[model samples]
Target: MADGSDPEYVAYVHGRAAALRRTAYLLCGDTHQADDLVQETITKLYARWPRIGRVDNLDAYVHSILVRAFLDEKRRGWWKVRLGVPPERPAPPHPGVEERAMLRAALTRVPPRQQAVLVLRFLCDQPVADVARALGCSEGTVKSQTAHGLAALRRILGNPLEIGMAR
Candidate 1:
C-alpha cells in the first residue's frame, strides 16, 4: 500500500502475487485486467486483514476475495465506461455476423456469473477444471453455469438459435 497497508497482507500478497495473477488471467484473459483484479483483491484483503486470523486456509480466503472482486467487477461493468472514444471491437468470425451480433447482445443479458462461465468455457475454450480454478468454484458449478448460460442464450436467441442443429 502507498500509505502502508497491513504488513501481513502485504507479505502474503507479495509472496503469492504470481499465483494470483495467473488465476486472475484465467478469469479475465487479459494481463492488464488481471493486474487490476489482483489490486482489488489485495485491497479487499486489507480491509478484513485484522479479522482474517480466524480463517483456516489463508490461500483459499485470498482466492475467495479475488473471485468476488472479479465477479463484482463484471456485475458493475465499470470498465465499460471510458474517458476517450472506445476502440472498435474486432469483427466476430461467424459468416452470419448478424447472428453473432445477436448472440453478443444475448450474452450481455445473461447473469454475470453465468456469462463469465460461458465466455471462459466456450469463447476462451478453457477446460472445466481451469474454469473452476479461475472462478474459485467447483467443477460442478462450472458445468451447471455452462448449462444455464446456454439455456439462457438459446432462450434469448429464440428461433434463430436452436438445439440439435448440425453446425
Candidate 2:
C-alpha cells in the first residue's frame, strides 16, 4: 500500500534505517523513543519524498529533521518536569558497554539542545559550519554549544581522554 514514487527514497530508507535508528537511539537514549524518532522522521520524509529525493544529501536532511524534532520536543516543555517514569533496565554489559553506558548517561544529563549539538558534532562527525547550517544557528552558537557540551560531558565522564581531540 505504498505510492511507489522515487525508488531511490525507498532504497535509501531501507538502507539507512539501521543507521538512523542508531543515531536516534543515541539522541533519545531509549530504544522505544529511538524507534519513535525514526518513525516520525520517515513519515515527514515521506511527505516530502519528491523534493527530498531529488536532493544530493538526503541523509543530512533527515538528520537535521531528527535533531529539529528533538529540539522542538524539548521546547514544548517535555523535559521540563519529571514524570516519575521508571528507568528501563539496561542489558548485560559487554566489553565496552560500560563506557558506552557512561557516555549515554552523560548525554542524558545535558540539555536537549546540547545533546543535539554533541551528537551531531561528535557522533555524526559533522563540522561546526555544517552543524550550524543544519541547526539554523550561528557558527558562534555552534562553537559555544560544542564547547559547553564537551565540557559538561567531560565533567560527567571525569574528563575522559583530553577534552576534544578525537571522537
Candidate 3:
C-alpha cells in the first residue's frame, strides 16, 4: 500500500483551507495566529490522511483539530505574555466608531477560552453538543462556559437588549 500523500488530500486541503482559517480566526481572534494554527492542523491532518479520511464526519474532525490547536497554542507561554494586547479591531460598518471600539475592547478583555466558547457557541451558532465536540469538553462545560461568557459580556457592555433590537 502507498503512503498517505495523494492528490485527493491536496484537493481537500485546498478546498477547506480558507474556511478553516476563518474558523481559526474566530477561535483565536488573531489573523496571523489563525493562519498558523490552520496550517499546523492541516499539516498534521495531511500526514494522517489515511486515517482521517476514514472518519464519517471529517469536517467536524478537522474543526476539532483546529480548536485544539488554538487552545494548545494559547497554553504555551507566548499567548500568555501577549494576552493583554487587543485583537486588531476591524473598521466599523457605519457610524458609531467609538461604540465599535468599546465593544472590541470589552471582547478583548474576555478570557481567551471564554472568547473561544462564545465565538463557537453564539457567533458560529453551534449547538452545545457540537461545541463540546469541537472543544473536546463535556456538553456541561460548553453550557457553563457559554453562560458565564454571556454574563461577563453583558456585565461589561451593559444589556444587549437595551442596546438595540435583537439582530
Candidate 1, residues 1-167: lDDT per residue as tens digits? 22333766778889999988887776665689999999998888788877887777677677767877878877866335332755345676755665555555566667778877887776557788866876778999999999998888788678576533567
Put down candidate 3 lDDT per residue, 1-167, tens digits, no spaces.
22345777788789899889888877766789889999999888877787764677777888888888877766534324426665555776875775746655566556666777888886677888888888888999988898888788788787743542346
The candidates, ranked best first by lDDT, are 2, 3, 1
TM-score of each: 0.55, 0.71, 0.75
List clashing residue pairs in candidate 2.
none
Model 1 residue 22 distance off true place after TM-score fit, in angstroms: 1.7
lDDT of 3 at 88: 57
lDDT, residue 38, model 3: 91
For model 1, the stretches where C-alpha displacement exceeds 4 angstroms are 1-7, 76-110, 115-142, 150-167
Q: Rank candidates by TM-score, best first.
A: 3, 2, 1
Q: What clash count goes with each model?
A: 0, 0, 0
Model 1: which residue pairs collide? none
lDDT of 3 at 92: 64
lDDT of 2 by residue, 1-167 (tens): 22337676688789989998998877777899889888988888888886663566666778888877777776646344333765444775674666666667667777778888888888778898878877889999999998998888787678546433455
Each prediction's Cα lDDT score?
Answer: 0.74, 0.76, 0.75
The candidate that achieves the highest lDDT relative to the unseen native structure:
2
**lDDT of candidate 1 at residue 157, scale 0 to 100:** 77
